[model samples]
Target: MDFKNSTENNEKVDANYNVVPLREAMCKTERRLRRKIDIFVVPTVMLMYLMCFIDRANIGNARLAGFEKDLKLKGYDYNTVLSIFYVGYILFEIPATMCCKIMGPGWFLPLATVGFGACSIATAFVKTRAQVCAVRFLLGIFEAGLMPGCAYYLSRWYRRAEYSFRLGIFFSTVPLSGAFGGLIASGILKLPHLGSLKGWQMIFAIEGIITVAIGLLAFVTMTDRPETARWLTEEQKELAINRVKSERLAQAVLLDRIDATKLKRGFTNPITLATSFIFFLGNVTVLGISFFLPTIIRTIYPSRTTIDQQLLTVPPYIVGALLLLLISGLSWRFDHRQAFIILTGPTVFAGYAIFLATINANIRYAAVFLSASTAFALGVMSNAQVAANVTSDSARNIALGTNAIFGYCGALLATWTYLPWDSPKYMLGNGINLACAATWTIVGIGAAAWMVYDNKKRDERQAAGMEEIVGLSQLEIQDLEFRHPAWRWKL
Candidate 1:
């Protein structure tokens, strides 16, 4: 709506179009486009991430269903299976992101889904611990593309202010998948062995088949970007494209050009490092609980059957999913990402602190709820916060890839978290988690302060006319992608 009156004073306009008409059109077009995108992109990606997460996660379920016992896994063998996947996961993330961008998300995402889904299917038939670990590693290679690629893809559709809400919707699937996967596993595990397949085998096969079906459908339903969204009118498309481009311009970022130096700068940025560390710690909490929640529940209710364990897992995850959405929405409505994020650290810390203090199964069970509801939700906010700070697509991708690598490293660490020696009462692991929670809280405070300081400095410099840049080419913007004095980070 901000516009200048032409010399004639009869019309308010800009070079692109008449401001009044454009705003009016955009008001309707953007809302509808968002609705369509919400319906199309969010569910599809959420389902994709759900399947992707469950494929990795179902191993824990499978373990409860006798995956480890049947294979005769000894000592750390099962943990190695969990940890090795992240090795491949860490290696393939950057390449998969590059592939997703090059091939277009619609095509690339589905292909990766199918690849990993097939690996999940292969996991059902593993004859040895070694075979299972190999399948998990290959599964990692395919699964690596999903989260980071989805993050980048979703960002294409909305501005930073609007982004966390959408990302929250997409990421809410993490806990939802756990809940759904629990319900699914509870049902699937009740089945009698069919043609030499155990209940756990059926779980992998059926879940993987569902993922493949979803992936095949993603090509039909998902669009690469708004500019190419066929469901929109050409006018809507133009307006949508310009909207995002304008946001980039306001942040002093280069639009539509890949700056090679962006990769270096994004990875090396102090802010990016701080945020990535936050992301890494967040993932540590996420994977540690996700992979070990059922085990934790089993400790609390030692007499329960596998079915009871599966069913019990549902409520905590369901709560986590709901809280994830609520927090994300509140963060967006208030425009305060950091505040919501810092609170999660205490929730995680309290979960562990309570566990470290008591041997009571009921209190420990309550601790599980605290851990489940906040850790992954915190990770969601962390990713959104990082995205808000990162302005360029390439830079965002690099920062994301770096985060993914660290995230998997957290996954790797998580695999070793609840050791065989620490069973039932994982006091040592809980202590480490408490320490991590404190680190996350402290660093988040520092990061928010840094943003406040930098924003204030930028305002001071701008008032003095000490900083200015406009309409720079990709070449001109080189070496100054996100650090441009005009770029102000979101806190």
Candidate 2:
């Protein structure tokens, strides 16, 4: 009887140990699903954004292709055209976000991309300044939701800890687009057989076609979520969904239903207002440099051919892309986002200041490259950092959209502020960019200080509630008043 009992006990221990293989198998399946999602997610987003950014800024290259001279543009007329793009963009941004929520990214994002592409292609045929402005405005209307939409969509798949690195990869395409745009524009400008159609017109026609094609491809392939993705196994899908929810729940302070009323409340919040203002200031500095940097380079190197001028624009974007990747990686590894922003802000300002003081061709070129690259990193890091700090899903979506709108508003202001009339030595434009950079630095400092103070209060509150056994929702914990100890900001 004793021998029999010992054997049975050993068999039970063996059964318990057998469960380990199942756990290992599940983990492997989850990892495979994650890899599949990333393969689709990273490329789709990066490509879409690349096209969006290229379409918006292609005007810079258009200017070099004799666009201004052909249209008889005078004294900020071109500026007005640039600014009008944002009017349509800002008007449609919020609506686009809502549409994404209703329709899912699989449908809405592609439709928007196609619409903008068609509008961009049509722009090539415009004969007058008014026609150009109208086409750009329409294009902006279609493209308005893309950036925020992608940001929000990706958030659905990734955990908060993973978001910054993914965002950095997605955002890195902006500078890469700048680099690729120069190369493409250079080749198109050299084409001689396109019938009286200028190089700039050809650039638009070809790029728009590519955008439409890519959009069509995305629509057919993009799966909305892991649970709904046909490629994922049942176990894989459950793991993916649960992992994201668990991360969000861990970070959330209050758990409220995300509804229309909550959205309205989010839109009206004071923090949202301050965040929007910061986005506006940062974007002014960003778009100002993007639209005018090439022009400024051309002024300094007036005798160079179109190809040479476009080539000159390369170094800045290259340096900018590298620095952006480095900073984003370090920020994620150390969980120290605010400190990086504070350090990067001055690199941008210094770059602008150097450009303002230089007249020598070599020195001016160096300054422009340094400024452009440094500003690229600063703009990207600041936007992603702020977006990560907000806990409400509705609030985050609206905040992201509002921030983009505000940034474009800055772009609109930049259009007129840095007119062709200013040309070679754009004293006003340079000064404005410098001032904007300085102001953003100050804003970064203030945001960091607020985060620190809020964190302290949260710690105190959590300590006081040690005896409570109640389960608080994420929003409640996230709220400043009901602060939880785990509610500290991620760098």
Candidate 3:
């Protein structure tokens, strides 16, 4: 341990701040800072996410506008383009997160956004299916960093109890993008053939341009952390820093501490891996629905034109977005995460059940509303849990990034699950989603139970003065604060 550095860090706090009760000061500063943080930081990042999701998934809308036919995509090439976004997406999530953490989101996020925006624009110009696939791959690499980066960024600003609502607010933007993208594409697709560009080309070019503009704004507006926030006073900064250091899930005990060893600890930890698989199961429903719902909706309304179908797609996602916000509010108010996640599984199960059992398109359409509402809400609760349970930034990058990879794996499954052969009546696809929901239900139950037991055990250990990691533990594991007996999972 660096005794000198530790003392200096501690004294810096004491020397600058007045002697006041921490709880009183925190309570006072928290209210004010919360408002400021919510206003200044939350909305900015939420906009970035909105732009991110819309651009990433607008290809669904683009497909309707003739992305597939224009390039003469043969065989499974369309699916290849759809699914290939994650090839780069899954590969770079962790590394990009690490970069975002190291470089600060202010610089890194905007840069990544510009990269994806450029890719999105280039996707409009592709001459062949190979070019489409290549640009989509590049788009994935840039967009991969944003989701996990958003999670880690918020972990720095909010405490455990406040996390879900903020996550819900930010993540709600994902489904909202569906509604927004559909509405935008409905109009954008009608642009008179510009030079040689088609409707789908216009969708990519217009949305991509908007995304790039926002990325430029994000560079100027975003703050690195509360302590480093130029908008705050020294006292406010101390209050924020102290509150985090005193927190159970503080990313780093000190602002400057990274502990590269936290990386190895996260990889080796059983609980971290378990949580990720839980994320994998939870993600299957949402990602599956997001990527495929437009196509699924097209089949549901066979009578409608592609533009009409695009217009029709907006309402379900709007409902899902609104419902996600309500659910996230409840989860945050109750301060229990798993119960909400467990409840969502059944909702998804019901939706999938209806699809598999019946031929009624109306009934199946209703099921889409039910499933998307629940699936999108799962991310609101699940993402907060990922942030709350992990110990440090390094560990968070590894664990959350690993979880994202699992998510894309589920997304990969989603692309396959609803094949054209099974379209309109996609019994096999619905059945697989049913199994996914059921597995997530089981995992949610087990994880909730384990958290209860683990929290109890930690309580017992702390009472018995046995908080420390036992003998011969590595330097990395020793630095992991989540291993302490005082740590409690937000069950």
Please report the candidate that would top lDDT against the real structure.
1
Per residue, candidate 3 scores C-alpha lDDT tens digits across 1-491 of 23224434554584566535553554566789788788888988898899898888888888887777888986777678788888888888778978888898788888888888888888889989888888888998999878888877887787777878999999899889999999999998777865777789988888899989989888888888876789888867766665655554433354444566677666655556665676677666777776777788888887889889898788889988998988888887887777887888888889888888877878888888878867888777767776667666667666666667777777766767777777778888888888988988798888889888988887877865453445635443446656655567767
Candidate 2 structure lDDT:
0.74
lDDT of 3 at 203: 88
In candidate 1, clashing pairs total 0
What are the lDDT scores of the predictions, listed in order? 0.81, 0.74, 0.77
Q: Name the 10 consecutive residues with the lowest summed lDDT in model 1.
A: 1-10
Ordered by TM-score, highest first, the candidates read 1, 3, 2
Tens digit of per-residue lDDT, candidate 1, span 1-491? 21111222434344565667655654676688778777767888988999999998988888889888889999989889999999999988889887777788888888888888899888889889889988999999999878989988888877676788888988988898888888899999888875788878989998999998989988898888876788878866665565665666333432345567777777887777887788788787788877888888888898999899888988888888898988999887887798887888888888889999898988888888887778878767877877777667777877777777777887888888888899778977788788888899999899888889988888778744323456666555555756676778777
Q: Give the TM-score of candidate 2.
A: 0.88
List ranges where model 1 is wrong by over 4 Å. 1-26, 250-257, 463-474
Q: Which parts of model 2 have CA positions greater than 4 angstroms off? A: 1-33, 250-258, 268-275, 463-486
lDDT tens readout by residue for model 2, 9-43: 55567554675655566557656766877887778
